[model samples]
Target chain A: MTLAIEPITPLPELHRGRSLHNVWARFVNRVAVLLCWTSALVTIGALFLIFGYIVYKGVWALTGLEFTTHFPWFDFTHFHLNATFFTSLPRPGDAVGGMRNCIAGTLVLIAMASVIGIPVGMLCGIYLAEYSKDNLFSHSVRLVVDVLAGVPSIIVGVLAYSLVVRPMGNNSAWAGAVALGFIMCPIIARTTEEMLKLVPKALREASIGLGASKFQTLFRVVIPAAASGIITGVMLSVARVAGETAPLLFTVLGSDQPIFSMNSHFPFFHADLNNAFPSLTAQIYKYATSAEPEWLKEAWGGMLVLIMIVLIMNIMVRVVTAKKMAGRH
Target chain B: MSDLPVMPPAAPLRRRANSAWLRFVDFLTFGGAFGGTMTLIGLLALLIGTILIGAFPSIHQFGFSFFTTSMWNPVTARFGAWPYIYCTLVTSLVALVISLPVSLGSAIFLVKLAPKIRFPIPSALLGKSSPSGWTLLNPRIFVTVTSFLIELLAAIPSIAYGLWGVAVLVPIMQESIQPFLADSVILSDLPLCGWLPHWHVGLYLAHIPGIGILFADPAAGSNMFTSSVVLAIMVTPIMTAIIRDVLAVVPPELEQGALGLGATWWQAMKLVIGFSKMGIFGAVILGFARAMGETMAVTMIIGNSRPSSYSLFSQGQTIASLLANQFNNADTDSERQALYFTALILLMITMLINGIARVILLRVTAGGKHK
Candidate 1:
């Protein structure tokens, strides 16, 4: 509802408007406003300052692209291994070393994680939104999901270490992917449920009216309507797990050397998911805490790349959402 | 003969086969969806089960003393978690104390103030007043960017914060804030303040050590206070976003009614906040959970030194930090099990807080319907 639009008034005249009649009331109101304004400034300033400082240090250290790429076959330093991807360990004061292996490892693990996570999370979401009735079972399931969302990442790491790493007799990318997949599941599932909930009930009814089964109605009509939201949720889940260091710390355990040791016999066909690998986030933690200035610089650069990926993903979500809204209109 | 042809019976058989195939597909897809939900529940159960089983060795060995013992001697194999637990509580509490007001204030600013001043000046009154100055300070540009900036802050990894804290904030604290506090007369000159500055309590609270160390003897700047500051900054985005969301759903009519009844904008906001108190509490609890479980940054900055001290300025070890620091190097079975115990504790705390928050949030949403 529109209120009557009044002309602009000076502070005193606005105070005169019966809403804040007394001088003390006006003073309190003004002070409250000032406090809030200052808080906004502080919060925004802190965010930009952290990002700006990282970029500044990162750009200064980014003298060469050497640190980001490694062509293992071309380098030909070791036993001429068939697996041609590895993250070279950062030697003290070594300027030539890069995180090619870490980047590749991160991509591989995330891809594996998404393959496992997305379908399961999306399916769970569909079940919650469409299939489940409001009953004791549904309530318990919801409670479980909520609690799972809050479980610490470190704990997840420990669980992975015990469950997968120990049983396999080795730390592996598969274990890390499983850990990351667990972290992604609750977030994706919850968001997907919410997104699907937003799909109009009438859409389901219309599909059913057109002689469609419940499965067809959900898959063809409701899912397409909520597709963008689900994609956003998936992207967000990937971004969330991409920066997680703790889960990977114990599971993948991080390698300094460039190694893609998944089934070596089938290089083209299989990834040795059972081998340790480096990741960008784990490298940042390792390098940042070290005393060497060179490693620290590389850490800053890695952090910069990570922040960019996360920001890009977040921005895409907004852009996609905006486009979807425009399309609806 | 026309009604009962054998060819028609053949057509019916074919249609039955197709329908049966379709039903099977439906059953398969339904099972897939159902299995996904079951998997989520199973994962949660498995994680908790693993932690509990791993924790058994430590729990069985230590008994009740596990909570009471202060020493964390790996050599003696005498593991006590009291220090780390204490550190977690102190840092999280301090972070909440610092961040809650600021986050709430920012939420209020975004929801209440920004909208009121976003309009263009009308007619000749625009130039007479200082319109440019007003818009420059409280511009639509500033408001939009501020909201987006909060989300960006949340997107940043905790390790980055740790890195920033160690590389940047550490020196600033060591060179400036710590030394300044140590030299300041506020601890010496003020009445009953000497004790107050250090969070010192008297004989009544004997469980606490003498003259609580919140501001006691200063060491290197990597201390409880520093970690708390970092945690505060880290969780502010979460707190502000949650509060803002809760505030958004508060019926505008409630606030408008307050305004119509001669209350100011700030007063109306207070009404909105009061109405959603349960939700705000839940949000703060969630933030507290975040602060307590935060690892990389707290580990990097908090110094992770042994012999835990209460001094906010002295080095301390949080449960999460202790886990992160020692997990890789835990050589013996007992040491590793003790680390598992730490994880179990941290997990329990986080889960409990989240559970409480969920309940509170449910109540808030349910209550909002009545109003």
Candidate 2:
């Protein structure tokens, strides 16, 4: 049997008139589109402009003008990396030397913060994702976490001062880490919960059907599957807290000496958590606000380093997330 | 047959022992997680408690007059949060004013315009599209790069912004922007003249009883206006990201349906925006909270002066900046308590704003999912 197909007729075009309403609507659409494009360009342009200015000033501060003596010709001798800027301790009376202590202090503080933050955050995330069923307790925890995330870092500093510093009788790395950890907890928890939620329900059911306990299933299967995402969250949180200056202001209080010192005996490295700790952000604040011109240059250099670290981490996370999204599809 | 059926009651005791151990482990893990969550709640409570305790002395001394009075003389021991509160509100409101339109426009562009404009690359030059048909140079990639750049703005340390404000923005504002605003006759005559203070006409209108004291001669580079601009820049990325997410969640069919019914692109956008208006409002509130709590950058650029006037170009202080400047060097116990009192107020304001924003945002996003 042959099927007969009828020829299709296109619908007649509707009357296209330049009425007042149509014209006004078209004009508004065009204006709206133009405004959107302009705003996007402006936002991107501002980012580039700020980044460009920073890079220019930062490079000038880092490399100095000594290379100008051999301008118009290639000379490798005068162009040397600012080694002293990263290696030596900051000098007094004159703002000279490097931010070695600050860098080391920042690292120590971050390590301490991660130690306190990661487990608690991950566990709380597990609780929310695997156990809670929209109950009041879990609901309140979520709300509190959101609120904590929004609380000003400076207020956290005040909390640290009152809770740790006042009790300890001085500013210390412990207090700084606690403040940073407080900031990191909610961020880490939020991300972890989100990541865990992304894992398929089938995976959990399969593990459970295999006779694995809930705890075993979470630790052995679900967590492993979501490991990379959780790591990304942790790194993002680290990047965030690494740049926090206010929270460290009264907590660590800024020091010229390194937070850790080498000892001659076994377990040689000693961390002085009892005293003020040097931190990159706190030191940057100090240098930027100081009266010395050289200190300002140092501040710029520190900012360049800090920005590089943060941007690199963020870019890495973006790339990972993009890859994961692509892979999922 | 009896011997086969009797096959050793399946090691029931040993199986029970193993199961019991697993149950104990599960209990411990659950307890640990519960403790962690409890710690978070405790930490928040402790934070509020500490600030309240610290501020108690000043709260007792000043009474409710602290909220109404503007006097903050430390030597005389008379303290009030009125000026700081006023400045904080003004700065945050100004920042919201500056950032909202820019962020909304950017979000609209990213969500609406970007996906429609296809790049005409040879399919052969690019690999075969994935199952999802997304390729390099697709809208997703463009949006990703743009969003990443925007978020980089957030990742920038506040102190860096402070340095940039002091070294770069302040000079520009002082040399050009402030002067232009102060002298511009058109701006002075704008319909919102009550709010848009000006220098040229402000002098004549100063005694008119209605004109604002916002615009004045540029004093130092660091002033209320400059700080507000910095805060606007700081909050723009956050607002843009949230607004973009909120807009993205609106079902494409809604906009398409509007367009299919012969509506313009702007009209369709208006429909979608109307649908998610609560979410956008929440984003604005979130940005406002961020601006209110911002400390280091505002401190660096706000001139850190005792608040005296509402002039846009005049030096002023916000609660957070005041706390940053004075918390360390607070000479007297009363002064310290006063600073804490101001901090407690800031904490309460930000938390309240944040809570409201989160609830609104949650409702909107959840509603979208349900639909």
Candidate 3:
């Protein structure tokens, strides 16, 4: 068979007008470069501006431990109340109270969420990466994970409210944890999958060649290899959920006094997890919107703590990932 | 070794028990992983199903008019979503308009103009000629630091941004940007100053030919403009990061080919961008989806008022802010149902946006494979 080839068409001449067009093009390129530089500067500057102002305004509240330890008191109507009373929730004009309960409550919520989310997410991720062999089921699961990650957090709140809070006949930390757990699941699972995918297939095959079962190979070799990435993903997921307010809005229901501490209970050691609890994020929303200045100040204090928690977790993840990345070379 | 161990194969019960334990573990782990995957699918279904079921009362009540009617009074039992939808779209649109160029420019700067960084230890660190700290002063360090700060900005909670917006951004907008635009000769002439309560233009500005300046009755603080500004800041990092990643993955050969043809650096970048337009579009849509669902900051800064406006300067409510403000305090069943309906709408929009973004991203990768 004879092969036929199409004739090449002649190309157009260059439109290199030496006078005006060249100048215009040159000017455009220069301006574009300048704008790009300016954009970088603006982005960097914006970050520092937000963080600086927050730290500047929030540092004073943070310096005192009162906000973190002192529960607010409502009835200081009698004379000569204890100085510790100053750490209680703000009265109309007093700024002495702290978000101790909120701090405790946030930790409890996160702990519960981690317990639910981490294992399940890791398992799912391992299955996706090491097993399934890119089946239609696995593809759909991956798609669903991405879509779930984008669900507006408030809708998650609403879901938790209906399923857990409403059914229980009250808002509780349990419901809040569930809502936050839903949010964390997709992030951890997807990250874990990606991290596990980066593990060498040769390692898996070698383990199998050594007569190791699939589970043993995964647990002994693949998982340990991808530990740093999985840990980083876990940290990032925690950071992501730590700042979430909308889900907790309808779930935790924000209490002023500490309710969930084990010491503050009837059994003396058991804490009530299924009760309305304070959270730093929910507290910020509550106090930030209050009519009183003292409450607003407390809100700022809560914001500082919240920011620190999130930023520290994120920075830790960054450091870990960066170190691992450096080690790869 | 065989002589030592061969004597242990006598007990059938023990051997069967050993195999049973192994089988149990095998069954347990495989089942656990499969169950975990199924849980994720179940979680999505429950979330969407609950929202839809919760929203059914209002959806049945309002039917299609829910999209058209702007009325949202709880006292009168009237609920409509035109204003909230309008505000959500307008705020997201405004944020995209403000952020797109900035993020694109910054991404281009990092991906094209920034120097390639090598994570090499300085020679002096190994007791050689170079100084130990020389790498600290590199310009690539500056770029890395900038990018780190951007990521940190992303990590910042929406509430903190809200706090900053309330404390800082609102004042700046009210004092600086608004007034600057109001007074500027060219910008002031751009129809922003005269959008009155009834959508009528100012008679004075209207009478002047080619000058349809629409000055909104400026609220003191916490307006649509402030919320949009915060939203813009909140989303810039996301857009910039995504675009940077997208551009990073664009094969250098595309640019090298253009350069080999004697094209300018700008032209080469333009060609690369042309090739990655779908990816960039996906990035923009992702950013928009993020902007639309952003809650605390927008709610805190957007002045969550009932009355909506056509102008940016007036206080407005997004669907998110509206749901946030009213969901918990909703006294009546219909009121609560209406809020759920709003969430349903927001959910559908976000899902659609993300779905489209994913499709675009897939197409970009598929196209790359062909090239």
Candidate 4:
């Protein structure tokens, strides 16, 4: 005696019957997917739009175009490369010149900030990653670092003003570097800690088993293992501080000449750390807001330069990390 | 015992000497690192102390009224932080509102939809025969490139954004978007309010009281709304990156289970979102804090107007912007102190937001690990 078996049937609502509930659910799903696609496209599109506009306007500015009566079109006859824009000092009083001084000043400021921020940040990160155990002190220190990272650049400027500028009775390059250093410190420390933490425990143990001291192991083995990541972090932090304008507004107070000078006396490579310094971002701000079109053009050019520096650094870091990731595979 | 090798006495001494040197080096490194950590602590204390000491005069003078009153007469030396606080909150809230949906949608697209998406490629182009006529687009590559661009957006300096805002966005807002919005508000009052007024889909939206004022006429284009838009653009990438990270951490098994249970892709996403709601909220809060503290871009376009009405079309000043604009120009010590007081307020607000976000995110990630 055999028992009869029946085939399972689909739910009436869920079948391909074009039921209202099924249709509604499908419609909703389609709409959601469509929205997501549109949003992603829009985000990418917005980035492209920004870059496109910047490049167009920046290129126009770089070529030193003269406005023609053609209304919105520039005379290509005047489209010569503006070499003076990179080589000559900024000309005052309606004269269009270069941002050489400001560029130099910016480079000097970044150098000073890195010098002050990098080692200290790396050491703090080393302590957090290798030495300090989970304790209240370490926890509090981490908390402070997190909080400090969130503090606005303008506030840091104010702090630097009071802590460095007011005591010295002047806005100076030193004060600006301090403000930027403050910004760079927490970022470097955070990244360094994270990168160091990523180094394998087995490697550390191997070094220890080889009779290496903790300090030697960390410096020679762990740090080297994490070097690429640490360097990437440092580069990113430097890029971030490079374009900071608000802090420099209060600290460096823009200058017209280069912030450094050569002296024949002792300390021959003299720096104007005691005086006002110009920076690319701050100078761009000053020029961009001016009523003069030439100044605005220069501002655009300066922006192009600044953007190039930052984007190059970012892309380099990305490429390096990508290579490292690929190599791991 | 007779076969045991003899050890050199000089070798033992050298070994001892090396060990001592290593110990000394270890001590030095430890001391240096500890000093660096202490420096960080000292920096924090110094930051707080500087702001506190600088702000004491205003705090003493105004007492609690500094936060309550709206008056800010520099001539009379009467200062109030209420207006700046209000502006900061309003702008940041508006920015958050504008950015949240976009960021969420993009994040969902990235984590859920990206992997399933495939592009059809012609066999001729590929130089190979394919039965399905499709090629995997490598979601990993797509996601990496998209995220890299988003990060580049964030890497673009605030000052650069300000430059672009002044040169490009402001004019566009003044000429097109603002006028269109204002016109739509008027057009919504017509009989065909529901359908004819294309932009006035916010007809019922205009009936809302306080929010209605936000859709007012465009001034110089450097108004609160414009700044809020800039802030929105500034923060969307950050919020999207964070939300994508959080969403990516949701267990794939949970999503797969939902799908296997005959749920649609959207339904699966809804489940994942519900699971990671706390983390998403934390991302929003972090974005809000960033918007609040953003200075140069907002300052360039916010019109730097002192405390005015709450109209989004009206120019307003935020705490950070106020500090940026006035900190340098303050002629008197009290005036400088007032700016300090504003900075203190801004600091507190940001710290509170960041702290709450950190706690929520920590808990969410920790909970995920436990699961």
Per lDDT, the best of the predicted structures is 2
* Model 3 Cα lDDT, one tens digit per residue, A1-329: 88889899999877674657767767877888889889988988998898877776565355433423343533333224233322455344554677766777788889999998998898889778877775778777888888888888888888988899888988888999999999989999999999998888899999889867776788889999999999999999999999999888888888876654467556776656777787889988988887877677677767777888888888888778877776676
Model 3 TM-score relative to the real fold: 0.86
A207-255 per-residue lDDT for model 1 (tens digits): 8887676767878899999999999999998988988887888789877
What is the fnat value (0 to 1) for candidate 3?
Answer: 0.66
Ranking by DockQ: 4, 2, 3, 1
**How well is each residue in A1-329 modelled by candidate 4, as lDDT tens digits?**
78778878876654662778778878899999999988888877777877776776787788855343334664466578988889988888689788998999999999999998998898899999998888888887888888888888998999999999999998899999999999999899999998899898999999989888888799889999999999999999999999899899989988888666798999888777788888888899999878988888888899988989999999999998887776666
Give the TM-score ranking, best first: 4, 2, 3, 1
Better of 2 and 3 by lDDT: 2
Best by DockQ: 4
At residue A174, candidate 4 shows an lDDT of 92
Evaluated at residue B246, the lDDT of candidate 1 is 79
Q: Give the Cα error of residue B303 in candidate 2, in Å.
A: 0.6
lDDT of each: 0.80, 0.86, 0.81, 0.85
User: Looking at candidate 3, what is the lDDT of residue A209?
Assistant: 91
Query: Per-residue alpha-carbon lDDT of model 4 for B77-159, expressed as tens digits?
Result: 99888888999999999999999999999999888776544555576664666787665544477778878887788888998
Clashes of each: 8, 1, 9, 0
Give model 1's DockQ, 2 decimals.
0.45
